[model samples]
Target: MFSLLRSATAFLIATASLAQGYSNPGACSGACWAHDPSIIQRTSDNLYFKFNTGSGIEIATASSLSGPWTLTGYALPSGSKIDLAGNTDLWAPDVHKVGDLYYMYYAVSTSGSQTSAIGLATSSTMDVGSWTDLGATGVASSPSKVYNAIDPNLIAVGSSYYLNFGSFWHDIYQVQMSSDAKTPSGTSVNIEYDATGTHPCEGSYMFYYSGYYYLLWSHGICCGYDTTKPATGDEYKIMMCRSTSATGGFVDQSGVACTSSGGTTLLASHGTTYGPGVFTDSSKGLVLYYHYADTDVGLGDGSYLFGWNVLGWSNGWPTV
Candidate 1:
């Protein structure tokens, strides 16, 4: 009995260490089907809105972070002008409000191919018919391109703005944006890359907390739903790095550069949850929202529920 107790204690300690600083808050119900979700809180009425990858870029609204979310409508019902590449299915959206207008950056790609383009759309109000598609941002990927132009995220630091994007081929890249937040101005710079794996990292979201710019991204195979999962047990994990400057010099906890294959695992396949997207929740502080295959809800049927957790800070790093 004593030996068994010691073994169990050791197992618990190991599990705790693997979790890092995050804890699963619970599953979100009612219109929770979301992948590559980007969240923003509207200041007009303080309502929370989440945009996701889907046919027309799915939109979900809630009053609070702990949501009784409802799928109201899609940002683009008629699909984007670049509908040939994205078809009706778009991927990985990043939404941010600039001044009185809201800007949404989304990925348009031909399924598995790297032929992709990042497009811009704007809305005065985040309603269904309010959004106006501004066409592509001139950032695109071709067969000869080394970087995949998808998963666009706009990071605003002070007066300057940067659009961070890329996937698969070379991972993440960033470029300084015009004041309008729609056009890329300066030269695009490589931000993060993993020299190993099929698709090392994607879905880059940069958050400025305390004095550091924390770069959070998803690593490993994503979007198998329930039909497939990562055999290496590394799929859809949230990886993180930090730097004082928003542009470059990001490093993991071990002081390893992000330009290398260095990233500290922030969240991984804990139980059924996977594919975490970190965002700031106005009411709940820092929140990590992801998708999970709930065994209780029938696993292999592609019924991945929404999963979320409030992140805590320890030693200037984010914890769940």
Candidate 2:
């Protein structure tokens, strides 16, 4: 009986360990229409701010990660000034703070074209009316260009800053940025790609943890809003790779290079939520903010809600 009790206790502990993962804290309220959300917490007031893709760039604020968020305003009311792409709706904003000012890198493009540009804006405060558009970051695309320049993310390593951006055509690319964080100071390098068919990787976000640079990205089709979903059920899952160096040579758990279409699945569509954005909160630590089509709310009815889960790490990999 003593041996049996010990075995049962061990089994229970193992089951609990395996069950550790992401959990949605609660429902958010007020102006929660968010997609590809990038969040930052203000150091002065401790208020949480979210920047998302929308008409210009949607800004929302809340006292906590889970809360009654209120729509503050748009980053650009007049729209971008990038030739044909300007004045159109912006997509996939990445926000970072340098010194005292906040720098927001946003994408400008037509609905389905490689002719796109990544623009920058800065503000002392993240308030909607305070932003000053700094124009294009010298990352632009023509019809002849192989990589689409959208979904921009900024990472600062030591004193150098690098910008990672790209979509469908060649997956994700990285380039060193000038000190101002606006213009590219070096040639762009292809960091992540998919050899499996149409190359469905985008939204590249790099997080530095425990001496490893974890490159997290969304794979497969996304942004169906309501009417559409990935044809393959497994297409729109969050995938990840890691490396000691931030610039290149990211690999999966099995030692396959990310440039060769290797990635470890982090999160997949379970229940309703899909297409998670890698985020970090002060209290919640690492979080995955995603959009979900509520089944009870029905599909194609335009009810995509924001969902989030605080991530747990095991063996240097994030699980959610």
Candidate 3:
């Protein structure tokens, strides 16, 4: 009995160590399903944080990139209402910090309609309860305008600001914001239209990398589980291209064009991986954060969680 007890204690210690291994970055393997990963790094402490799509804006973060993550908190408060009816299609949530204040951008619309619009909120803290919605923008800031406005993200170049967004109704467009990060400042520039497929390209995430502004988007259908099986092309891949300007005519480095129904694939269904969001890590450089649609955990239905991989540039083109 004494020997058995000692052996059991040893096993428990090993288990604890294994579980705690992810406390160090680059210690774990194969956790790729992060959708629209918006990353923020606190320069003061030199720690990076990830906020992406999951069960009601689920948030899991690690001390560093390679992590055994700890679930910090949801992006939304415990009972916050995204939709009036509480439909909970909390698709893409982008979180970034400006000075001491943190801002979150996200979408709220049910499947199969142009009724969706992207909304914004701000908080000084990471806890979900602190955020306050600034309202939606698409067509005249109308909450019910219904032109499929979602996935609003920010691009700041000095005093000028740009808001990028789009959905099924049309192509992704960007309008300058008034430096204050509030109202529109100029006419909207139409970026990419009807990207490379029947479905309207959505989830437009923009970041400057390698001296060019890259627009990474997910083309093809996403998230419809009314039926037991999802259709082909429902959710599969990610494609990207870049341009010299903040608002493109963005193209791949090879001069391959990124237009409606046509852009280069950064990632496509691989062992379950799908739809990627691009971010430039200060230390890790370029990183692709996305989801794997058919993983066993969510049954491949795009009930997405977070996964990430380091990105590298090869022969002037970006690859995972």
Candidate 4:
């Protein structure tokens, strides 16, 4: 009865927050099905584009936040140059602008396997046919490699670039990138790891705000929802750590070292929202754009939808 009461209270709080119009994601229309969404606004036109996991990195565009979005098509219509068996479907795209060009780092691998690679593609203009595939970044993992390489995110600090990618085997790892930000230039650094419950964590996005660099990633089970799903609260949620240096020494709110599996829950299952992965955008006051499974729409992974919320800050930490 106590557990039931706690759950009911949590549900009410979540519902109230949504009704107040602050916590609920902005209304999205048109092609809303997306997973591992990475969003950015084109500076020239201020148009919103979201690249997500798909066969060739599916893209969607919208005029504004609350709008009828349109599926623009794939970034790589011909699939990736990566030739791993059963890796035709690309996954976990992270896009950022370097100088005047847009760089998209994606994953090439099948589910639950260590034989994976992080591939790169660049575009002068982020149009359907503008992308040029650059193939693998030499950041790959085989059965012998300790860490599985997937879910790539690049962060540029001053004149240096770092790529954060990893999953399952060792949670989250980082590697230095060359000036072009396309290939790894340094050895791997283990930044964050969660040893609890299958070590399920990936989709890391690093952002700099104020004076601290925030490392955010998705934790818990993220897929296989069509056939089986984790228990309510045990499903996917957003977790975060922050550091003064972009390379290492990250910690949670309580100052526990992130490399030792310390993480603060940034967002979790609330109301109808479940299993969210985030992309931070500065166009709208440090908003978090992500994909979540709407309980009302069924539990299938294919039923995931795009969502976003303008983040608030309290005591130098981000709030929901």
lDDT of each: 0.71, 0.72, 0.55, 0.76
Total backbone collisions, model 3: 21
TM-score of candidate 3 to 2 decimals: 0.76
Candidate 2 matches the true fold with a TM-score of 0.89
Ranking by TM-score: 4, 1, 2, 3
Q: Specify the highest-lDDT model's number.
A: 4
| Runs in model 1 lying further than 4 Å from the true structure | 1-22, 298-301
- Reference-based TM-score, model 4: 0.91
Report residue 57 deviation for candidate 3 (angstroms). Answer: 2.8
How many steric clashes between backbone atoms does each model show?
4, 0, 21, 0
Model 1 scores a C-alpha lDDT of 0.71
Q: Which should have the higher lDDT, number 3 or number 4? A: 4
Off by over 4 Å in 4: 1-22, 277-283
Candidate rank order under lDDT: 4, 2, 1, 3
lDDT of 1 by residue, 165-236 (tens): 887788889989898887889988898989986656777878787788888777776665456645645556
Indicate whether candidate 3 or candidate 4 has the larger TM-score: 4
lDDT at 101, model 2:
93
Clashing pairs in 4: none
Error of 2 at 100 (Å): 1.1
